[model samples]
Target: MDSYEKLSYVSITPHAEFLRNFVANTICHSCKTSQRKRCINMADDHNLCSECYKTAVFSIERLPYIVHNLRKFYRQFNLKVDKNIPIFLTDKVEMRKEFDDKTTHSMTVYAKKSTTLVIKNCLWQGEKMEAVKEPKKLSKISILLRFGYPDVITGARLAHEMMNVWLGNKGCMDIQQNIKEGICKVMAYKWLDWYFCNYVDSSSDNGRLGLRYIQIYKPEIESNRAFRGAKMAVDKYGLKHTLKHIVNTRNLPDVNQATALVKIMNEPNEINTVLLAQEEMVEQRTSRKMGLIFS
Candidate 1:
């Protein structure tokens, strides 16, 4: 596959480019530039242009989404929690069948009250669910406010990254045929990425880590608003399971706060080229893995 246009995020490859040229030259990423210093991005391992290098060199801003991404990933994947989240605010949920094939399946969820969530499982050739449980509500926003932490927002790019990884993998066991789950994972990664990129990316002597010193720590509210809107799009598109996995647990080391941001990057690409043909059942049947003849 031509990685640049690949259907998966690993195919969405990152590159080291001249940073200033990117801002004035390209509008794809958020722009930040004035003084130049050469440095490298540690997480994705891309070289930073000189303007970006200075902030990392002079002050103490850290890399993006290292811990929160790792922690969120470990908890859902390793701990075996259902990363599918339906409605975060109310926590009520129900799950039902969407798609079923020998190699692929999908489910839906709905919420009731007091954050009560329901999940259903229907698969063609896979094992049946042992049971489903109502998920615990993430701590209330009021509590986080009392504790004086940044309110969690959706992590956009991180979720996209996870989705790409899940979908793009050559093996079915990698993330399984759980297409609904694949959506959830992508949501998580994107929400966190939005948080981290805003928190971690900047040029300043008194950096983002020292945010406590400032009376206001909301330079990124515009991005935050954008993310929330995208998240709402998820809700509108009927993907609540995705919203839950992407919300951050409260608490952070100041240096690692960007990790929390990784929980909800909050930006959804306008183009869903990867799943453009997903609605076409015939195309899905003719897909490489399964060769079922549709009725």
Candidate 2:
């Protein structure tokens, strides 16, 4: 790209022609332009002069853009997300709208029978139990990683789930019946951050933007790419025997494996328990004529 086309941090080429045509519109009678008032994108209010707008456009719009983008301006920044992770996205079927009958209520009510995971508490539970709650410090991303991406759920599922949740009651809203859904939503949002956004440069800062663009564009991955790459490295040099030696095993269900684990549990403080002293010489010195005391 040439210098002329290079993206500038500031400076906007106003659409004077568009604004003029719009201002001339019969519906725009109340606009500041009708009173010979200048309207700059930087203005706090539409009535402000172009000279005053010199500093307002970039800074003020940051907050309002975030708001408007989610609402009426969805089409402006509605990103194309890719499904790379095995994340799932589903919408509610408006069965309730069709019937106000009992069957509709029964189907809509997702909360089914609840079952206890532990029927018999452990010996530790025999004592008085304290209020058990989740650690509040765990963010959504941390929670998803802790859960380690549930079965058949991928990053793609996460991205869409996040979008749905973020929109709240709008745009394909539905009840998330599973705890993993909550996890997936959080993962989806973070995943979205990485997929969306157009960064100006390839540097780390802009690299972040580029990544955000990707997350927004492509949400799911079919494989754990880094892990797959590592697996490929395993066959790089036909070092199968080397890995076997490192593992140190005979056949299945080896007793040595258990013994090795136990030894590891109570590790030695010092290596090779050996002393230079001779038992015979020490016994000779300590023996007070006590049965020759020799080994």
Candidate 3:
């Protein structure tokens, strides 16, 4: 299997040269240098060359078909991709599947590494779901917003990367299948928070941590101080059960105040006002409940 293409920015593929001679009168709106083989024609008078057109169309439009073909390819070949193997997209393709039996053909997906055939309890081999349609109109910004920046790669090329890399051919453990099958709940900002939580070790240089725990916490941890206070509380209390304590005890709405509170929490000698408030609130609540029960 050819190594899959991994693109960080969008550009024209060399194969696009084959497509250029066939197209007439259309110029690539993106690179102006390449004679566009096809125009995305996304909007009024707006057109992208063959490479840009494919990138925009395939990343969103051809995702389902590509996924279907990959599933079928895996099933027919009985190849096993290890759980830890890293996959990449390649320019090479060995097969093409149409969207249906009638209309013109769709995009082609590059094949992956081939090994000895071994049939296991495959997860994707089940009843097929109706294909989800990609919206006809999508801005470049929308594409970037939904799925990060577009690297110059064919939709089939990108599909190759997605299948081998993120989607990992782990039978039932496949994220592509899980997402398409609706087996796992998908959330927007959770991806962002997950990235930050794992990659970012500390708050930003200006003492700012952008809403790290906003999705889970009520009233939302919007400030750095509240986040630090929450962290301190998490160390003492816990994540799942500490929202009430953080919300009630520490309210650092101002950035400056939050910064100051963080300093307090860090110092061993100084009393952390937020932590003190939390402890006091817990004691007060406990006493009140005890008094009511006794009375």
Candidate 4:
């Protein structure tokens, strides 16, 4: 029987003894060597040796890319990736979406013999149990070492952004799930930032005449901050009105004011106090620059 077909005969066993025995007996999906205590359970009933598992963990955020590139790297020398090795992933699926459904419904896993895992808790219905401790952040040093120069800097920047999003989500400590959710959130934020920038940048000259340019060119602004600023201005200033209403309005806020509005929205209490103290200084500086105030 084929290896995949052999997996069908394997029962879903949650007994710790079974996990140990399985590891001891199975040939590593990577090296095809029966290395005792060196196997880890992977998706779709496969197991990888410690060395192969470490490689996968190192490529966590960019697993698919790394796998593809690995083949390409070897192909340059006219070789193929070893076919005997197992691919742990059965299907490419969004991690967050899959886990979100499980979490939301409080679904618990129970080891079944073949297809599904099922457990009956009827006998211990009233038993008390200790709460599960939250998971901690996973280290990425191995992954970081793989990058060089600008790639390292870029990776650090994105990782920072992803951490912010993850924290904002009150992320669970589960390392794999956290990373997946963070990646999804970062991608969404980037799309929105790009959308807004392109929409504003591509508008006609009349629409781009003044302060809007500042928003278009705001360097290194977080997408969430930009979004909050736009939202605040729209809600507070009735920016939803017709273009005629906007054009006829007097003392309309310029782009700098809009960005300041964003900052205030994001850090309301702290920014309010700080802005009050700095307002006079900023005004004086502006006046001097415009030659309205002599030095």
Task: Identify the leading candidate in terms of TM-score.
Answer: 1
Tens-place lDDT per residue, model 4, 166-269, is 23234223334333333333323332333233233334442232123223222323354533443333334332221112233322234444564455445645
What is the overall TM-score of model 3 with all chains considered together? 0.20
Query: Quick one: ranking by lDDT, best first?
Result: 4, 3, 1, 2
lDDT assessment of candidate 1: 0.28
Local distance difference test, each candidate: 0.28, 0.26, 0.29, 0.30
Clash count for each candidate, listed in order shown? 56, 33, 7, 0
Model 4 RMSD, rounded to 1 decimal? 22.7
TM-score of each: 0.24, 0.18, 0.20, 0.18
Lowest lDDT 10-residue stretch of candidate 3:
121-130
Off by over 4 Å in 3: 1-40, 43-46, 50-253, 264-295
What is candidate 4's CA lDDT for residue 202?
31
Task: List, residue by residue over 1-295, the lDDT tens digit for candidate 3.
Answer: 2111221222445234325323356665434544444543321133445444333332233444534444443332233333333222111111112123321112212242332111111111112101122212221111111121122122223333332332222322322332221111111112223323333333442111222222222122223342343344444432222323223342212323445445544566323444445444544654564355348
lDDT of 1 by residue, 1-295 (tens): 3222322222221233223123223211111333333433321122334332333211111213333553454343322222332212111112111122322111222222333322221111111101122344432110000000122221232243344333323222233233334344335433443343334322443333222112122233223443354344443332332333333221111222344333333345333322222223322332421222112
Model 2 agreement with the true structure over 193-223: per-residue lDDT tens digits: 3223221233454343334334333332214
TM-score, candidate 2, is 0.18
Better of 2 and 3 by lDDT: 3
lDDT of 4: 0.30
